[model samples]
Target chain A: MIEIKGLSKKYGSTQALSDVDLQLRPGEIVGLFGPNGAGKTTLIKSIFGYIPYSGSITLDGEPVTRKNITRLSFATCEHSFFPNIDAKAHAQFYKDHFESFDEKRFNVLMEFFSLPKDKAIKHLSTGQQNQFEVIMALCQGADYILMDEPFAGNDIFNREDFYKVLLGMLGPDECVLLSTHLIEEVSGLINRAVLIDKGRIIGDVQLSELEESGRDLMDYIKKSFSYRSDRVFEALDQLVPEEERHEEMA
Target chain B: MKKWLSVLELHAAMRFKRVLLVLGTMIVLQMLSFWILGDQSNTQTFFQVLGKIKYGWIFALGFLAMYWALSWPLGRNETYSYTLQRLSVTERGSVWMKFIFNALCFVPLVIVQAGLILLMAKIFEAGKPFAGNAHGILIDLEKDGMLHALVSFSNPAQVIYRIVYILIATACATHMEVLFARKQTPILSFIPPVILLLINNIWYDEFHVAFAAAIIISVICMITALVRCRGKKPLRDILEQQEV
Candidate 1:
């Protein structure tokens, strides 16, 4: 289990994360949903020890040091790959550094994505690069996989297929904490949703609970965020003149 | 140990092309210098040819290539510093491995320069009375200030001083590379090595004091650099928050 407690991060004057607490267990896929600047990326980076934080994060009761860091893998839209290296070379690198690297899964994903294995990552299309990023994170064979908008550049069809591929390839011991804005897209894939706003987690809910209550995932989010359904109409009414609105209605 | 080798291999492979380019250009320029400055006269000395070669420019180009290679992990597209920092290796070990790998990158430069010197020595052997031999050629070339610390292998004390000097220079450059990776411009980091080199040149006769000072300064610079590599609270963190 990966546990985070009282996590807080301050970027100079801005609080990127504040008193955030979360836990991730094996065999579960959780979606971390947040608005822009809501601290989703900051939270993930903090867990990976990419940045220093004020709170404690541990894996299996030990601090996330180099000894057990291989248990975690990350994929980001900003890309953490060597641009000069090709896909095959990346597989070789992962194999060298990560003892649990799954080369078979890497090859399978390369073929599935139709990514050119020989081309350097920088030469690949943006969508292909995104795919390769996620592929590396998955094939690292880590127990906890953290992805931040890994499919940002990928098309909808590609993302849908990838989500299915992810579900099929994950073993019972694997856990995924995926942060993306496409909440509805991953609604079917993730079992739990972790929602954050203003640098604080506002809601954590299980999909099974929402299903039992006959609540749509979107409706649940709307209620959690106090979605103003008529605010759009009110803003439009204010923008348009009364005479113009009446003429359009007529 | 195997992981360190993998890291070294990755760095070497990534840098192979650019190193080749710089070395190729350097050799061609040296050859061109020999051709332009060569005289068939029996009086030709290795110094005559080396004197005409733009040694300063070559050194700058070679060292600049090394600096560029050392900065690879901090590239803009993806900061592999994060990758390396999270590795199972100790922070100090990783920094040392990277520093050693960069030092190795300079081997080709030395080989090329040494080869040129040997070739010149062979070509100008007929003028031995004037050119003196390969050892004499090195002794002759050591007259220059910067090369003074590096080439006096004949003297045991000089050998030790040279090692310390080289370590200081390499460590300073590595420190600068790390700072640059963090997007911090450290113009001051280049000062210590330059001052040491000047001490070597200006106080060549008073070897004991200069050597002691060099050893102390090199050790200090190395410790400072290793401590900065810890990445938790780098000395430069005051400049700005480290994004890595």
Candidate 2:
């Protein structure tokens, strides 16, 4: 389990994360949903200790450090693999640095994605690179896998296949804290939805609970965020002339 | 120890090919230098020729090119550093490993210089045996001045000072490149070497003072780099905003 408490981060005068608290447990696929600049990336980076924040983050029982960091893995759209090195070399690197690196899983994912093992990762297409990034995170054998928009450039079909692969590959002890804007697409895949707005968590809901209440994930998110459904129409009303509006109504 | 070796091996593997390429190129350049000297109508002893020839620039350029190449993995566009930081058991170890690797890369250049000098000396002695001198080919240390002072190995103080200065300069420069990659302002990286050179130029008579200053500044730079790296404060403002 990863526990974060009173996490706050500031970029100069602007607050990136404000007293944010969240916990991730085993066997749960949680979707971290937020609009742009809502501190989703900040939260993830803080968890990884990539950036500093004023809070306490503990993995299992101890603080996250080199000794215990192997338990957590991350995949970002920006990519963390050595660009000049091939995927096979990356596997060797992971195997060297991480004791729990799953070489078999790495091979399987490489074959599944049809990524060239010999070619440098930088030479791969954008979508293929994204797949490789996610593959590495999955193969790290980490208990908690944090993916920040790992499917950014991938096609819908590829993402669908990956979601399926992820489902089939994940063990009961593994947890995935996924941050993405594809809410409706991931609705069926994730067990829980964590919503953040303006650097604070607005809602955290279990899919089962939403289903019991006869509500879908999107609708529940809309309610929790107090989303203005008529804002688009209101903006259009201001854009159009009164005569044009009347003509359209007629 | 095993893990440290593994890390070292990984670093070396990533750079071994490029280092060899650079090393091979430098060797060719060294041979070319010798060839050019051999063609000259007015032949001189090894020390005199070495002091006169402008081949030192090749070594300087080689080291500079290598420094740039080594900085590639840590550049903003690359991600090897993220893996490296996470994998390293201690940031200090990473610093030391990089320092050692970079220092070792310069060793071949010195070796090439030594070998070239001996080869040039033998060729000079064998080709022209017209001398009433007892040593056959007279070694005029004073004739070659500064270059001789640097690589002659005749003056123990000068040799020791130069080695210490080069090692420290390498450490500072390598550490500075790392700090720069992490988005930190690293102007201090060039200060030690530049200051040492200026001191050497201005205070040639007070060599001991310049040597002591080199030791002090190198220690300070090493400490600063180690502490800052261990802190790992990559700028938060420049953090990649990947999420929507």
Candidate 3:
């Protein structure tokens, strides 16, 4: 279990995250949903110890620090691997430092992605680089894996396929916190959705409850970000005459 | 110990090919310069001809090697969060590992220099330059004595301090980049070396003092770089926003 309490961050004048509290538990796939500039990346990055924050974060009851940070891993869309080395060499690097690294899992993931082990990772297309980055995070054998916009470069089919593969391969003791703007794509996949906008989290919903309410997940999220619910309807009404609006409504 | 060595070896491996390519190029260029531009007409010994071209090549070598060392471990654009988090040691360990690897790369240059000097000496001995004075070029350096022009490899003492001094220069440049470039620290990062160089110039006498000065200054700069690296903001910020 990982816990964050009163986490806040600022970048110069911009408050990237504000008084945020979140928890990541074992066996849960938590979706971090937010609009553009919603501080989705900031929240998770702070939890990962990428930046300093006012609050405390703990991994399995221990305070987060350099030695214990390896227990949680981060995979981002922007390329991170050394461009000179192949995927195999990257795996070796992880294996060298982290005792929990699972070679078998990495091999399986590579074969599934059809990633050639010997070619330098820099030569891989952007989408493939994203896939490899996610693979490394998952196979790092950490208790919690955090991904930021990892599926952006990948095709929809590949993204869908990876979601299923991830669901199947995740150990019961491991968990994931994935941050992305593709709310609809992950709407059905994630168990719980945490929504943030303008540096603060506005909604936390168990998908099961949202589903039981028969409210569309995307609609619920859009409402959280909505200032005037009728604004769109009013604009459309003006764009189309009353007779046409009535006809469309009908 | 083993993990630390693994880091060094991996870093060395990543750069080994490029270093070899550069080493080969420098050798060919040096040989070409010797054949074409060497001061054969005016000087007697290989050392005098070599001295004319030495400073420029040394500056070039130091500058090139130092730039690479500054970006050692990884490039500016690349994120090290993944690598740093996985490391068994502190982030400071990353810098130390890079230092070892970058220092090791200097070894080949020294060996090649020694070989070139020995080969030149052999050529100079075959009645090649003087046809008169086999004692070799004591030309402008006669004040330093003819013995100073003796082939250096047979006397390792002649080359070791020079190698150490070059390594120190490279190390200082590297630490400056780590502080000024990577960490985005204040201009104070440039101070330590300047102060140390001043002190070193005052104490300049033999290999003993130069070696001591180099080791002491390199250690201090490494510590400063590491302290700044750890205490400073994570590199992810610049990498996140910059064109890289």
Candidate 4:
């Protein structure tokens, strides 16, 4: 389990996150939801130690450091790779540097995706590259996988297929913390939803609770983000001919 | 140890083609000059050629250290954060790995320059219109009262000082690359190396001061890079407020 307490991050004068507190338990898939500039990426990057923050964070009751970093895997919309090198070369690098690297799993995923081992990663199309990124994160032998916008560029078919593959591979002791705008698509997969707006979490609810109350998760989430139901109707009404409506009324 | 070697091997693979392209161009240009200037008109006299080559080497090494060597160490901007996260390497460790790999890559540049000198020596021994062999040219230059231009090459201690100076220059460049990756403005990112190099130039006549200055400057650059990489942020709270 990972625990976060009194976490805050500032980007210059802008407070990106403010006194954020959270916990992540194993064997659970948690969906992180937020709109643009909502501190979602900042939070992910903060946890991964990519940015500076004021916080106390621990994993399994020990402070996270370079030595224990391998226990967590991460992928983001901006694909991270050695563009000049091939998958096979990267696999070798990962194996050498990460004792937890599962080379066999890496090879299997590469084969499954038809991502050629010898071709430079830069040569792959954007969607395929995103797939490869997710593949690398999964095969890193991390118990916790944190992905931010990992499915942005992928087509629905590929995304669905990968979701199935990911579900099959996740062990009972593993956990995945995912952030995506495609909340409805992952509505079934995620056990809980955590919503953030203006650097503060507005909603944290279990899928079971929503299901028990017969609430549509998407509608509930849209409410938290302040989505108005009348906007579409009002815009369509503006398109009608005012003179024609007046004549009909007369 | 194995991880470091693996990174080295991977870096070599990534850069093999570009290195070949550059080195091959150098060799071909050298060989072409030798072939085209076969006992010909108004070309550089052998001593002049030798003088120019020595000067050329200094400029080439300096240029490579300043520019070509740091791009990889900076780690490409687009993929940097993601790569670090997935690979699970601390920023400091990643920078050091690339720095070492780049320093190692510099070995071939020296070897190729050495090879050019050997080829020139063999041609001179074979009675090409060369005035003297490689080392002999420096000896001849000193004999001809041309001491100022070649004084650093004239003594072993000065040669060692020159090597140390170049190391500091390159080390500063590598750290600058890290700062640049941090997205510092152009002038701020460039100040440290420029100041250090300026100090080296000012103290050039006083060898010990210059050497000590370079060492101190390089140490400062290294420390800044280390501190920047050792950010207070830890990896456990990765997504407290992140929107997917």
Q: Which is the leading candidate under TM-score? A: 2
Which runs in model 2 stand beyond 4 Å of their true positions?
A: A237-250, B33-39, B42-52, B72-74, B117-159, B195-211, B231-244
Which residue runs does candidate 4 get wrong by more than 4 Å? A235-250, B7-16, B33-45, B51-62, B72-76, B81-90, B124-155, B185-216, B231-244
lDDT per residue (tens digit) for residues B1-244 in model 3: 7678777766666667677766777777767777677767776555566665552354255335544544444444456544664566666676677776666666555566556655655566554645324454333223232123222444576556556655665466547646544546434434433443443333324435545755677767766767756632456546345321
**By summed lDDT, which 10 consecutive residues of candidate 1 chain B come out lowest?**
B231-240
Per-model TM-score, in order, reads 0.85, 0.86, 0.82, 0.81
Q: What local lDDT does model 1 show for residue B37?
A: 59
Q: Local error of candidate 4 at B79, Å?
A: 3.7
**Model 4 residue B25 distance off true place after TM-score fit, in angstroms:** 2.8
Which residue window of length 10 is worst by lDDT in model 4 chain B?
Answer: B234-243
What is the per-residue lDDT of model 4 for residues A1-250, given as tens digits with 9 covering 90 to 100? Answer: 9888888987656888888888889998899999888888887777766667788888888877766778888887876677778898888878877788898889888888889999988788889889988998888888889999999899999988888888887889888999999988899888889998778888888899999999978988988888998987677569867676667779
Better of 2 and 4 by TM-score: 2
Native contacts, share recovered per candidate: 0.36, 0.46, 0.32, 0.45
Q: Indicate whether candidate 3 or candidate 4 has the larger TM-score.
A: 3
- DockQ, Cα level, model 1: 0.30
| TM-score of predicted chain B versus true chain B for each candidate | 0.70, 0.74, 0.65, 0.63
Candidate 1 TM-score, C-alpha based:
0.85
Stretch of 10 with least lDDT, candidate 1 chain A: A78-87
Q: Which candidate leads the pack in DockQ?
A: 2
User: lDDT by residue for model 4 over B1-244, one digit each (tens)?
Assistant: 6765665576567666666666766776666555554342343445555544443434253435434445433234445445554444555666677567656545455456556645664665456345555566545445422222224365786467546645665566557656555544323324434544444333334445545755887777777666666543322233333332
**Interface Cα RMSD for all candidates?**
4.1, 3.2, 3.9, 5.5
| Best first by DockQ, ranked | 2, 4, 1, 3
Superposed Cα deviation of residue A210, candidate 1 (Å): 1.6
A28 Cα displacement, candidate 1 (Å): 1.1
- What digit string (tens of lDDT, one per residue) describes model 2 on residues A70-183? 888889987888776788888987887888999999999999889999997878899999999999999998999999999999999999999999999999999999999999
